[model samples]
Target: MTRQKWTTEEQEVWLEERKPAFLIANQKRCAAKSFYPDLVKEFRDKWPVPPVTQAEIDDAGSVELATRVKRDKYDKRTSSWYPNNTRTLSAHGGANEILKIKSQPQPRKLQAWQAYHALTYESKWKPHVNKAWTTYKEEWLAEHPKEKPEKTRLEVMVEFMKGKFNEENDDMKKRCEEYRNPEMQAVLNPAKAKPQAAINEAFQSAINLLPRTLATIGESLVKQTGWNITILAGGPMPDTDGTILTYLSHSGKTKEGDSFDKFLGKKDYDDHVLCPFEKFLHASFSMDGEDDKEKEMDDEEWKKQNSESEENENQTENVDQTKNGNKKSVGGLSEYEKSKAKNIAQLKLVMENLNENYPFPEDLVPKPALKKPAAKKEKKEIQQPVERRASMRNKGGDKDRYVM
Candidate 1:
């Protein structure tokens, strides 16, 4: 029977699933097969072949055999299978290549490569690096060129232990391997461990002093001056241990403590203790003054001037009040003098008014106490209310009351 030709769709499907090794296997008997002519010729040159069937070529066993051969050859390169120069691969240097294969120390029961493969599938690690085992292994080999390429982290650790202390039958080959783990190196080296305690103590001391220093400074400034200074405490304390570690960290000082939640519940009761004397010295000069004696004299003179001016103002005010009292005081008129003045005014006014027409009211009659106007003047009404008028009518009330 004549074979049916594959349709375009069937040809596309064949290409998609085609394997070079399978195609090469089939070319011997299936001369009409169009796929992989170059691959068939290449495989035939590399491996001797008797007549092979298409069915046998498609079988997975053939592909498995090809893969195993390739893997075994690759394994040989990374080992001492050939001379060092002859075995050199293009990508991996020969010495390093062999090291990569054997570097991973084996578990007692399993080889290092087997341990790596098993660990890759282990439930804990599979999530981080799942099917990309080849890429991960390549990258690990690149970083740890000095490390045994075949060792797992755990296996490397064991070998590390044996090399360090196992001197009786020390394996020189194992000890030559270098593992460059910075963290591990630090732990292994004794010199790195000594200063760590002092560093830790200093850090603890600084953290503990942060709150106490702030509170003390705040309380001292308040007691010295009446002005209530708002000390913002969210930042490092100013001049803590007399060190200028930083300037103020808090924003403008605020009355609301809720704004500085980090610095809550701190206070101090001590009298103002100055930040250490070293803080005041800007190189050689003191902040308060270079010459203490001169500064003291200046301060004393300033105080004396303020005191004298205040006393002078008080004395001048008292003298002005005394002069005002003398002006307000007037002697009382005599009763006899007043009566004689009234009689003389009555006779003169009667003689002068003999030609006047009508009699005036009895209360309207002139008295010596009444004064006559020298010329015509405009009369103004007194504006005081009745209560004010009544108060003003009393004699002692005028002297006791002061007007602005």
Candidate 2:
């Protein structure tokens, strides 16, 4: 029997009729190959490639072209291919088509980090990204309402910055209120309220006692100094009768003549007395104006002694130069003079600390005055009132008015 050649229209009709069966067969083959790749490989190895003639090659190429055309037509009609519009497998293709389907390009899902970075940095995409994220969160919550896992990196960053934003908002609100009120302006504006030097002096004074306290009492006690000693010692309790309190009471007298134990239990003596005494000792021994005055006097005495020593040295050198025909030499300050200078420097440091710790009021600060001239002026001013009264009495002929 001879094979019959079909016209173009007839071939199209035939292919359309056979398309469903071809697709069913292709799907079954793909499933089998996917499930049993080893079996497929073994079968291919058993039936290796056969030699092809020129006529066979030509026929195969023509058939492949036709299959491709049919696949394209079917894809265009159904729009069923992937987004790239690329076919992965075909009924007319080989086993490679099945593998292609397995390795088909999937839609690229956004990673958490990538999505977060884009949302944070890309202004254009932020709204859309945030909307999508909000939707995802709503859906996720709906699915797993009760479950709460650790926050993601983006979530943590947002939460941390959120607090900063709130603080900034509060500060802005305060500034706005300050702008509306004239009285609050001076206090609210840090630059205008306190001068930098005053602020620095206050800080220096506050920290001046720190070094001495640390040297005397260690860091632990200094850190815990804020706590009440009664709380540190233990909760409220009655003091023992035969303790150090009794001995101290014997050494000292109380206003009420109460026993030391009773006094200790009644008031917070540790806070009122001991702490203040310690601070006083630290300040007194550390450095003060009295120490500075003493150092200045010592320095003057040292200068006088140094000058005398230099003069004596010069005289001795002159004598030696006359006796041995050697050159005369000048001498430097004595060791005692050098020691005085060092002591003065130490005293000066103390004066600085005193000034910082105990700042004087502007009214109390003493101003330089010419004592003799001021005294004379005050005397003349006082006599003027008396002289005026005397002249008035003499003019009025009232001698008794200005009594002796």
Candidate 3:
């Protein structure tokens, strides 16, 4: 049985597809570095060796010539075989190069480049990336101690990228706002706000006044210490009520009786205080400057007292243990007899090594006197104050009172 060649019909279809097929082949050859311009020309010259047109031949002899032309030019050769060629594609040797022309660099969106730059070399972003790297690597290893270094690095990078993008895009800022106080929010609104028009009202009405509130702090510090101080007020002053409450509540000595309300002479400031109008403005703004030094001192004192109380308790426990051991008699032996028996072992060791330096005096010593046991301090349960009876009768212009 003879294998049939492609008919004219099959050949035509193959011919039509040749260009794109050739391009694909060329790409593979180029990737393999076997398809230079010279090599491409040689390949085109060798393979698509176009057939002699039917119009070029005119008779039976020419038809025989065409058959001969097809056989000699394509069918007879095993190299670069395709549709009409007898050789199988898989049997043919592949081009040395498999890739085509260098791929044109893909066009990047501005946002993508911005992100890449932030990742690789941005100075400001480097610190955050470094921080993420340190935290993730340590935590990942701590959680998955047996993981390989290569796997751990990849995992760390994934978590770090997630955190980095969230922080850079202001997601962290939004989260921080959830925990911010109402008074702080009022002052921070302008800083967090966007656009000139939307923020203008919040800015002018609230944020703009922060400096004035801060200035009053400096004024108060000067009044207190008579020395200049640097003020770092980041935002606008609080509202009037917030200001007044802050001043009245926090100003003046924490010790009894020197409160801001009393110092300013709430009822008769016009005569009692020299500068009534200035005091009113200062008090109105609620600008009680922070005294960190005083707070630190108070904390130290509290810690000292707690430490002392702990030491005293430990000492009392030691004293009680000694007293119990001394007074209890075991097997009818007196307290003195028990002490002698305890030292008997040590005395024997001394005798066995007479030449060795003695651990204690030649005379067998008694254990030191047991301390007196501290009296067991009984805790008295506290009694709540008794409620007084309410008077139903209305009295002339007097408010209700209760006795302790």
lDDT of each: 0.33, 0.36, 0.37
- TM-score of each prediction: 0.14, 0.13, 0.15
Off by over 4 Å in 3: 1-116, 119-121, 149-155, 166-404
Best of the candidates, TM-score: 3
List the pairs of residues colliding in candidate 3.
Answer: 31-98, 31-99, 32-96, 32-97, 32-98, 33-97, 210-236, 210-237, 243-286
What TM-score would you give candidate 1 relative to the actual structure? Answer: 0.14
User: How would you order the candidates by TM-score, starting with the best?
Assistant: 3, 1, 2
- For candidate 2, the 10 contiguous residues with the lowest summed lDDT are 241-250
Residue 234 lDDT, candidate 1, scale 0-100: 24
lDDT of 1 at 275: 16
Better of 1 and 2 by TM-score: 1
lDDT of 1 by residue, 1-404 (tens): 84553324643343334444344544454523543354334434544343444554465368666555554443343222112323336455542242111243542443333333333224334443433445556788799967756746555444433433344233432222221233332343444444855765666455444322333343334333322233322211122322212111121122342212122322210001011111222222212332221111233342343234335443432222222221111111111122334544554554344325224334335445323443233112222332344542222211111000
Candidate 1 vs candidate 2: the lDDT winner is 2
Whichever of 2 and 3 has more lDDT, that candidate is 3
Q: How many backbone clashes does candidate 2 have?
A: 0
